[model samples]
Target: MPRTRPLPSNDYARRVAGQFISISETRLNTSPPRRLHLNVNILHSGFVPSAWRLPDADPRAFIDVAHYVRVAQIAEAAKFDAVFLADNASIADQIDFRPITALEPTVLLAAIAAATTHIGVIGTASTSYNEPYNIARRFATLDHVSGGRAGWNAVTTADLGSARNFGRDTVPVHAERYARAAEFTSLVKALWDSWEDDALVGDKAAGRFIDTSKVHPVAHRGEWFSVAGALNLPRSTQGHPVLIQAGGSADGRELAARHAEAVFSAAQSFDESAAYARDLKSRAAAYGRGPEAIRVLPGLTTIIGATEAEALRRRDELVDLIPWSYSLNRLAGTLGVAADTLKLDERLPDDLPLPGGGNGNHTFFHATLAQARTHGYTARQLIRALAGGGGHRVVVGTPEQIADDIEQWFKGGAADGFNLMPDALPDGLQDFVDGVVPILRQRGIFRSEYEGRTLRDHFGLQRPVSPHASADSGLTVNA
Candidate 1:
């Protein structure tokens, strides 16, 4: 076969062998080893509702940019993955006693992004109240400004108080909200994917700034939104801002399966958290997505001290600071029972029913009940267990003990990671970073230094391809 095409030579065999090894390496690189992820929740004061009353706590810190910037600096120094800011349209907490979710999330996060270099900035936005186009542009702008360290926590406004703020007398029905959310989220993603990856053509000599042909209108007319134009801004550095979701209702689960890249969940027990992970991943597979596509991060509040005894003492102090009337009222609100009916020393009512007619926080109501039932905890005990956060699980112990619990949850498949909410800010978080993070690092489950420059990189997520581009590249536009 000394013709035009000769027989394979030794050189050809060597090249083939190199290519096979290259392919294997590529696969290995794409699937990074599983590790623990952490994001700190920067609620006013801290996770403990009365943390502002602590000696070093600032009364006006909720509105102070300096306080947030200081926390961001600490988190960045520790190589934390992100800092999350949760929002609600109306006052969700007791304003007179402690700060509420006061600042607009995206706006506040914009300031945080300026002060920090690498930590991811995430904020909540309600799909039920926002226009898809506006949200798409806002998050895209944030991604671009932050150099791709931006995430959006998608939620439907959960209460009638929020509805009243928007001029509606009643909250939208549960099904209606989810239906709108699914469509709204889909439309926002479509708008993000409207422009092709090659759409930006900056040719200074020729004076052609963009390739108009590569840009297309989304033209979405869905049940919830009617968006006609392409996004004014170009695609951000990360392609699209990372999508984060939080909800526990059945409809909420389905929506997360279809769209979320990360989920913030609230489960009271290890078994419950693991079950939720399984169910969500299975649903995602049914939607033609891989099980590894989404990361499940359940909320974990910690009260850490030098010793377990001191940790319990600190928790007792915080619990004492909270007026019993407020705890009783808050628990009553979650259980949808009368405040007078709930005695602080007694266990939750055995015959408790789900909130009447879906007019409350469905996820946390169920979670709170489940925890109470599982532990047979009294109202006072449950109040202390939650550390003033309505349904988030609380862990009170020394730094070593806290690290052990986190490891158990991560290795046991109870969580992909945790959204850590320390009992107090700056100081509380500082203790975890200085104490607990070292243990995680020594165990080889958390990163000692950031591996990538973007939020998706930090999460080991792939940059999405333009849906309008060729199918051979792996992305397809369904809308």
Candidate 2:
């Protein structure tokens, strides 16, 4: 007969109760604190159009892998949450004056991932141009290779240049692009969930390698995509690479609420940013997600100097380097108006309708318009305030001042953090890391050391569990 297990004694129960009370006391003493997340945008030379023309800047840095690697190394040393790479399929910018987004994002980010261990690698891929399967696979592979430090920024390309590159003479309408994007994003998430966490058995003794019943075929048939089955590879770490979105339209916000784990926002004022955040979180709640499910990181451009006057001088110097014609043309492009229409000393046109008749970039248009209207700035003053950039908020100050602005935004519920675009790369980023990061650390809002390895962990997001594992149902494997 099997021996009977002994029941717990009264003394044992009292000991257990004592241990529980101790743990309860500890929990009472400690509460979960809000942390600030920071990511750096490696925009070729930097945010400034004339950044490459700096005496120490490299003209070829836009295409140089070494230059990107150096920047990633600096960000890693500073313990940044991620390094982001933006993409454009065509020559959208005036390449004659400045560098364009030349390198493909995922590819470049993979190289950056190889060079750094802790920093997350996020890359933009337009749903308008690419198939969902390819994107799902590419990011999954990146996650596997980088030890789960990959993120996909789903975006819709609106420019005619990108449309023509994809064999379309006319750009798709705004609604259609977003509709397709919604389907594309859903299908990608399904594909990522096709394989169960325990699907790979690898049992050498029994010669049973995989639990075929555990792998699922998504069979997703949507208006935009029709995927037959499961992905070719196993489910990646962190389940799926973090989904990030950057759009400010109503449709964009809805898409973000449903799919995006993080959003890169563009707002010109604190009130605007706070309102945006509140609206976005409410939308997420409507989708049955918690308030903490999404992170709002507004785009911020910083021009750092030892003093306020010096920072202004630096801003002027960089702005001066950009030709007036280039600035006018760029602003015109963003506003969807002819360069001749914008007078340097005059305010923007009163009836500046949506760019491309309401199909252009809504985020920048609204942000730039808000800045102009709020401050009553002329075209020249607007350009100066933007620090030669188009839409993002620009902060020019010393390290302490920069820290103060960041702390205010973070605590005021305006932003979870910022997607920082320094005035220049390498040196500019180095200044922030060396000067500003210490101040942030001292405030206890930022991390001194990385708490985890994966990008999701860095962002304080939970690792998504596969549906197959949760449902415990039969799965059909595709050949």
- Number of backbone collisions per candidate, in order? 0, 0
Q: Give the per-residue lDDT of model 1 (tens digit) for 11-53.
A: 3423433443344346446776798989999987898888999
TM-score of 1: 0.92
Q: Identify the candidate with maximal lDDT.
A: 2
**Per-residue lDDT of model 2, residues 1-479, tens digit only:** 11112213423323433443344345335645888999999999999999999999989999999999999989988899999999999999988899999999888888888888888999999999999999999999888878789999999999999999999999999999999999999999888888766666665556766678768999888888889969887765566799999999999999999989999999988899999999999999898887878999999999999999999999999999999999989898888899999999999999799999999999999999899999999999999999878899999999999999999999999999999999999889998999899999999999988977879878877666666653322222211
Cα lDDT, model 2, residue 329: 90
| Deviation in Å, model 1, residue 64 alpha carbon | 0.7
> Distance (Å) between predicted and true CA of 359, model 1?
3.8
What lDDT score is found at residue 154 in candidate 1? Answer: 95
